[model samples]
Every structure is written in structure tokens, then in C-alpha cells.
Target: MATDGQILRLAQWLSPAYPVGAFAYSHGLESAVATGAVADGAALTDWLADILRFGAGRSDTIFLRAAYEAPPEDLPRIDALACAFQPSAERRTETTAQGAAFARVTAAVWPDDLPDFTYPVALGRAARLHDLPLGLTARLNLQAFLSNLVSAGIRLIPIGQTEGQRVLTALQPLCEEVAGLALTETLDDLAGTSFLADIASMTHETQYSRLFRT
Candidate 1:
């Protein structure tokens, strides 16, 4: 469980209004929709569930846990590993941009820990500082990803607001499952199996008129 203050801080970082430019990127859902791969709310939900099971959810949650438990001296190595794991140029750029921006904003408010804070690191430290449990922190991190993905899906598929909410509601169990799994994962266990999502993200670079950044 998270202390109220910890929840508040996590909310600030995870909120869509945080100015991380999270709204501007769809994580390839836009491309997937444009190409007719994701045609409806059910399809969108399925795609997102796959991502939660095997893509960003798995990899990022592992990194978040590692950063949370790691000695402060090992942050640089973790950052390097994170940078290297991103295979797509767009994905790498997006993560770097968001992580750097997250570090900047958190630094302005809490300077002492900023130097070693990658995005996940900052989040974990904030959670720990405020006495939030690891499970809650991990769930919030995964929720942020799901929220961003659905936001992208809404735009790309042009789905109704109600429909988007439906998709999110449908994935709650899976989100909990992923969060639980994340708690026990090592960095070596981090892996992504969503090749279609990766390829779509890579293809977005050459897309003539893209609505989302990646």
C-alpha cells in the first residue's frame, strides 16, 4: 500500500498532464490502427494485453524493480542497459526523451536524488521516499503505460470515449497479473515478445504522415 503522499506524488508523475509529451506518442498503436490491424475496441484490448504480457510492461517493470533495489552506485550501468535494450530508433528516442524529461521535473522538486534518477529510478525512489510499497509502485507504472496506450488507441481508431474506457476496464486483471509478475522478475527476465508492435514502431519512422511521435 502507498501512503497518501506517495500516491499523490505518483499521481503527479503518472498523470497525462505531467508535460512528458506522453500524449504525443501512441507506442505504435496509431500505426497498427492505420494499417487496419486494430479495428475495434476488442482488438485494441487484445493488442494492449499482449503488450502488457510481453512488451513494455515486462521490460519496464523489471527495470523499475531493479532500480528500486539497486545500490545507488549502480545507476549508470542500469541506464546503459536500458538504453541498449531499446532496439528501435523511435522507441529509444521516446524512452530517452521521456526519461530525461522525468528526471528534469523530479529534480526541480527533489534535487538530492535527481542525479541518479532515470524515469523508472525516479519513480521507484519517489515511491520509496514516500513509503509506498513496491507492488503499488509497480502497478502505477504499468497503469501509466496502459493509460498512454489507450489514449493513443482512442485517437488512432477514433473510438468513442466510452469505448476506450471499456478497453481499459477489461484489462485490469491482466494489469494486476503483470504487476505481480514484475515483483519477482530480474533484469535477465526482461524480454518483449511483441514483434508486431516493435515493427510497427520502427515503421512509424518512415510513415509519411504520422499522428503520434512513435
Candidate 2:
């Protein structure tokens, strides 16, 4: 169990205003909206659910777990895998850019020497440095990711605030489920079958009049 101060630190790191610039990335949702793939609250919920179960959400959770548990010397392999795991250029940019920014800011404040890594890998290192529990870290990261997406959906899909909150509320159980699985899972078990989401990311790379970087 984490102490109260540990929990607060994790919360602060995962918060939306943490300087990670998460608001500038949609993880492909903007393209989904443009293509009419996610046009309403229900569609948005299903899209998010699929990703949580079988997309970046699952893979990132696994990566975070692996990095949190692995020795510092082994993190580079994990980082390399995370970079290669990105299927699209835009997707790659999304993770690496945020990861870089996250590492830069956290290292400056915490005085932990961090290697260049993707967001999940960087987060896992930060968790270890802060002595935060892995389960709590994973859960909070998932919630943050979901919240960022819902915020984007509010802008792109035009969903009302209440509807957006409902969508996030619906995903609470799944967030717990994914976090639990991530805690016990190994890197080899990582796989994401959210093909439509992957395609949307690829399509997002060429999307005209975009509001997000990915």
C-alpha cells in the first residue's frame, strides 16, 4: 500500500495540468470524428472501450509494468520496443513527444537521471523513483488517459460535458480491470487488436484541418 503522500504525488504526476501537453494529442480520436467513426456519445464510449481492452491502453499498461519492475539497465530494451510498437508515424510522434516532455520536466524537479523513453516507460521509471506502488500508478495513468480523450471528444465529437462524464464513468470498471491485468502481466503478453483505432491513427497522419498532433 502507498502512503498518503505517495498517492498524492502519483495523482499530481498524472494530473492533466502536469505539463505533459496531453491536451494537444487525441490518440487518433480526431480522425475518428472526421471520418464519422465516432460521432456520438455511445460511439465514443465503444471506441474508448475497444482501445482500453485491446489497443494502446493495454500495451502501454504492460510496458509501464515491465519498466517499473525491470532493472534500470534493462529499460532501454523496453523503450526500444515501445518505439517500434507504434504502428504509425503519428502514433510514434504522440508517444515520443509526450514522453520526452514528461522526462524533461520530471527529471528537472526530481533529480532522477532518466533515459530517453516513451511515455509509459518514462512513467514507470518515475513511479519507481518516487516509490509509488505499481498498481496505483497504472490505474491513475489509465484514468488520466481516458480523461484526456473525453476532453478531446467534447471538442471533436461535440459531446456534452455530462455525456462525456458518463462515458468515463462507464469505463471505471475497465480501468480497474486493465490496471489489475497489467500488474500481473509480462511484456510478451502485450498485444493490441484495435485495428480500427490503428487505422484511424494512420489516417490521422494525413487528416486535413487537424486540431491535434495525432
Candidate 3:
């Protein structure tokens, strides 16, 4: 059985019904597939694996954990950190829009006192308010990210439904590792190393025909 708080948090973040618009962004997966960078199941698996292991998984997790534990006064500093971390213009826009969306939805429902919590910070605070364990919160957030990416990949690569599920299954181990790593990470550890992804996101902005916002 689940606790009331845990259930509520999961309902808010993990539900496809949430209005965060998370389902709309691929985090650059659409651009990569359009460019023939990720064509099939194996390639999709590899790309998503790298992201979970090295990109958002590591960096966003650190931010989320720190935001979860930071003093309330430090929220603005954390938002600035989030802004600094995103190097690409499109990616930056994506995070900012999503963060804003999350803040709006949360504010409408819970009405927190802070001016605006960045996406990761708002999520951390929401998790705490909903009584979610840190690990569960991180895991679910990462899962949503991967799921959205794959959903975008399915459209861009024009793959069948089965292939998408296979890709998702193949990346499960990597996602688990990422979540475990995030649980013990510190704020100073917030970083990512995927120049290709950054470049792809930047290029995506100028792409004449884009299926995704980022």
C-alpha cells in the first residue's frame, strides 16, 4: 500500500494527465533522429543511455537534490544555476518553459509563498510537500524524461510501437544506475558532458522543419 503523500506526488508528477507539457518536448531526440543520428532500436537505446548516464540524469538530479535541501532563500541562486547549466539556446528555452509551466500548475494547486521555483526546484519542493522519498522523486522524473524522449524518437525515426518499447526496456539498467547515482550526489557535482547533444539542440533551433520544440 502507498502512503497518501507518496500517492499524491506520483499522481502529480508521473501522471500523463499533468499539464506540464512535458510530453511535447523531446530534449533534442527529434532533431537527432531527423539528422539520422539515431535511426533504429539499437541507436535509440545507445543515445538514451548516454543521456541518462551523462546528461540530464547526472546534472538535473544534482540540481533537484540540492533544491530539495537548499534554504528557501537560495531558490533564486538555484534557478540561476539551472540557467547557467543549459548551454544551448533551444535547450535553455525548453527548460525555462517547462519550469514556468510546472511553477504555474503547482501554484494553482498548492499556492506556495515563493515567487517562482525553477522546474527542478519546484519539483523538489513538490516532492517534499507530497512526502515522496528523494529516490522515488528522482526516479520518476528521469523516467518521464526518458519516456518523452522515446516518444519523440518514435515519431522522428518513424519506428513501430514495439521498437519503442524495446528501446525503453534496454535503457532500464542505465536509468536505475542514474537514479542511484543521483541519490548520493552533491550540489557541487552538477555537471554534464555531451557536446554533441548541446550542438544538436542549438542546431535544432535553426532547423527549417522541427517536430519538437527542443
lDDT for each residue of candidate 3 in 1-214, tens digit (9 for 90 to 100): 4577686777676666888777777788777887889898888888888887778767887888887777777878887888788868877777778778787777787775534555677788667665578887887788777887888888888788888888888877778788888879887777788766777887888889876888
Model 2 stretches with alpha carbons more than 4 Å out = none
Residue 37 CA displacement from its true place in model 2, Å:
0.8
Better of 1 and 3 by TM-score: 1
Candidate 3: segments with Cα more than 4 A from true spot: 1-5
Backbone clashes for every candidate come to 0, 0, 0
- Residue by residue across 1-214, what tens digits does model 1's lDDT show? 5578877877888899887778877888878887899999999999999988988877888888887787777777887788788858888877778877777776777654655344666666556555667888899878888988898888888888899999999998899999898889888887879999998888888888888889
- In the range 121-154, model 2's lDDT, one tens digit per residue, is 9999889988899889999999999999999999
RMSD of 3: 1.7
TM-score for each candidate, following the candidate numbering: 0.94, 0.98, 0.93
Per-residue lDDT for 68 in model 2?
Answer: 92
Q: Candidate 3, TM-score vs. the true structure?
A: 0.93
Error of 3 at 25 (Å): 1.2
lDDT of 2: 0.92
Better of 2 and 3 by TM-score: 2
Q: Would you list the C-alpha lDDT of every candidate in the order shown?
A: 0.81, 0.92, 0.78
Error of 1 at 99 (Å): 0.7
TM-score of candidate 2 on Cα atoms, chains taken together:
0.98
Ranking by TM-score: 2, 1, 3
